[model samples]
Target: MISAPMLDHIVYAVPDLERGVNDIERQVRVRPVSGGTHAGGLTHNALLSLGAGSYLEIIAPVPGSEAPTGALPFGLETLTEPRLVTWAVAVDDIERRIEAARLAGYDPGERMAGGRDLPDGSRLTWQLAVRAEPAGDGIVPFLIHWLSEPHPSGTAPEGCQFVALRAEHPKPESVLRVLRALAVELDVNEGAAPRLIATLETPSGRVELS
Candidate 1:
């Protein structure tokens, strides 16, 4: 059976990287760690350490850039602004987990190689399955593997804490089931509206459901 290991990161799609980063910093009170650029000109990434082997990420397409060199691996092109788009869950063995997911009746998609630039001008490479499309109504989460590197959270900025997570519609219990079935450790609360919310405690202040 496919088992999710741990919560990886939450993603937010924005129109501008700088603007998004700035806004997130102001709200969270801590600047996110730069994650470099993607294949296309869609440069992005802000890493917020969420403690306990987890973190939050804000992603967006860089303006005036080409549509991405090859194909739009993940259905990232279809995402709207400020929406909770994609997320990752850690796995001990990616290949084994992929096979398990296939057995669980998920397409599992194709494996792709991608790189992210660090703040110090260094680059990191990793591989993961590209979802054919964004998880509609926030039902699904994008699966990922970190290749051969440790999760960035272990070394991300200090004083960042993952305060809380909220999900809308579709029921957080249902979502929690999928995550649990995947072997991920998530504490979800039901009986509330459908909205995936995450609160972050940063060095500067607190960021709630943003």
Candidate 2:
């Protein structure tokens, strides 16, 4: 038997935030609201409520802002179009999850702290396990611990819910192993290249984002 973690949020990397907002609004019939800025000031995001427990995050570099070290997650530093990028799962015991990944032969990276300020001036603080290397081509999700902060999905733009979230890869079984370590599941198919696919129910009917 395999365990699956509860989803927290999914990321959509875009080149221009305003343009990304326009595109998402067109597809879902609702606009994403500004989600505040990263501590590094290199990136800012807008968000949409996908359901009760999860939301969609569209992140892009802050125009002329500089990233601290390497490229931003999901390739946002040089993103041309909006991409599904990656997802996050909520966890109560992040250290345990990281150890599980290590035992499974995958370094889930270190648990780090980060936060963003909401529009009303309230701050949201959380910790997450970032990957040491770009594994699974952004298909594998990072692990997040939101502490006691109110989840963004509750107050984000609503009217959408995920119908399906799946992926394809050359080695489905190997990828499945990593997902198992993270305690998350996604429908995986054998394909030439790695890809993430998600289906959503929106005001404009069903929309697919990947």
Candidate 3:
């Protein structure tokens, strides 16, 4: 088994951002605050604080936004349901980790840079290494490296903590191997389909999102 990475955040993709915000608010009792738009202008998100240096991002493609070419990350365009489509993990040195991953037989793709403009007019720039194909419909995580800036998770609306994060897949062992390669560990249970289930403790007790 390879070493997996630490959890940075999870991505919940929806077609409409406002609707998703309402859904999470009603279910979790915590409103996600606007995090801003992606550099490609293809998607935007709101964030909720999940204690312990982690957070959740409810992302949706901006209405009428155009990604002229190439694939949008996280499969934002294809998401029909507000589901957990993908996740990210922090890396101390992205290039070094990329080389390591390649040597291990996994090409996580090249380091790409982008940023989003916050409501306050400030930009949160970051560089990430996203795999060409997010296997298992994003059950696998891409890599991220924040460029000397404060992470958004720390400043999000506070009131929740991740209780558990798990994976359900028929071929659990194979998925577990890829997760370990990224240095991420999630409890796996056999199931017909692959999905991620995240449990968060909030003022409303507990909220589970998959």
Candidate 4:
């Protein structure tokens, strides 16, 4: 089980934004709040609180938006259904963390700034580190440093508690090695494919989302 203190937020990607929100609400019994649109108009998102400091991000294509200028983040364009695509970990000095990971044989790419407009006319800004290739196919977490105050979790819809996180990968050892380099720990099991499994305590009772 991964520690909650080190966990930031988990990403749930879908092909249709509103449909995904409804499906997740039906399962968890908690409606998500609008988190607002991203830069490029390629995607938009809604947020659900996963207890203090952490949340679940439901991301998808912005309806009627222009064609993507390039490949979308997290492969949202081709997802067949809603899936636990990846996750992020809050960190300080993200650039330093990226350098440290590279020294340990894993490169988390470079620090990049990102922001989205909030519903209240304010903007939420942050910097993140992501690899050109998905880090361990999205099992290993990326790094994020929030530049804004009073994190999104504080204002998101509540009632879900993040319980545990783990993964299944055909090559567990390789994934573990990268996690070690980043100083993060996770329960991983050998399996046929790479998948992230998150256990949560929702109003609907205990549930697993992957």
TM-score of each: 0.76, 0.92, 0.92, 0.96
Cα-based lDDT at residue 175, candidate 3: 79
For 60-159, candidate 4 gives per-residue lDDT tens digits of 9886665545567788666778889889999989988998898998888889999998878888899999876786789999999999977988999999
**Candidate 3 clash figure, as a count:** 6
Worst 10 residues of 2 by lDDT: 1-10
- Candidate 3 error regions (>4 Å): 1-5
Q: Which stretches of candidate 1 lie over 4 Å from their true place?
A: 1-5, 68-80, 119-121, 136-138, 170-181, 185-194, 203-206
lDDT of 1 by residue, 1-210 (tens): 112234677777676667777887787777777776766546567776778878777776655655735333233555456665556766556777767767665555577776787767766777776466533344456567786565777766657777665555536665655554454444555544445566767776776653
lDDT of 3 by residue, 1-210 (tens): 112237788889888999999999998888999998874677889999887778899998898886777446677767688889877888879999888877766667899997888878788887898876776557878888887456887888988887777878899888777766765666777899988888888889988899
CA lDDT for candidate 2: 0.83
Candidate 2 lDDT score at position 102? 90
Number of backbone collisions per candidate: 12, 1, 6, 0
Identify the candidate with maximal TM-score. Answer: 4
RMSD of each: 4.1, 2.3, 2.5, 1.1
Error of 2 at 59 (Å): 0.8
Q: What's the residue-level lDDT of 133 in candidate 1? A: 56
Using lDDT, give the best candidate's number. Answer: 4
lDDT of 2 by residue, 1-210 (tens): 112236678788889999999999999999999999884777889999888588889888888877667677567777777788887888889899999889878888899997997778888999989875656887888989986567899889889986778888999898888887776778788999988887889999999898
Clash pairs detected, candidate 2: 5-183
Q: Residue 130 in model 4: shift from native, Å?
A: 0.6
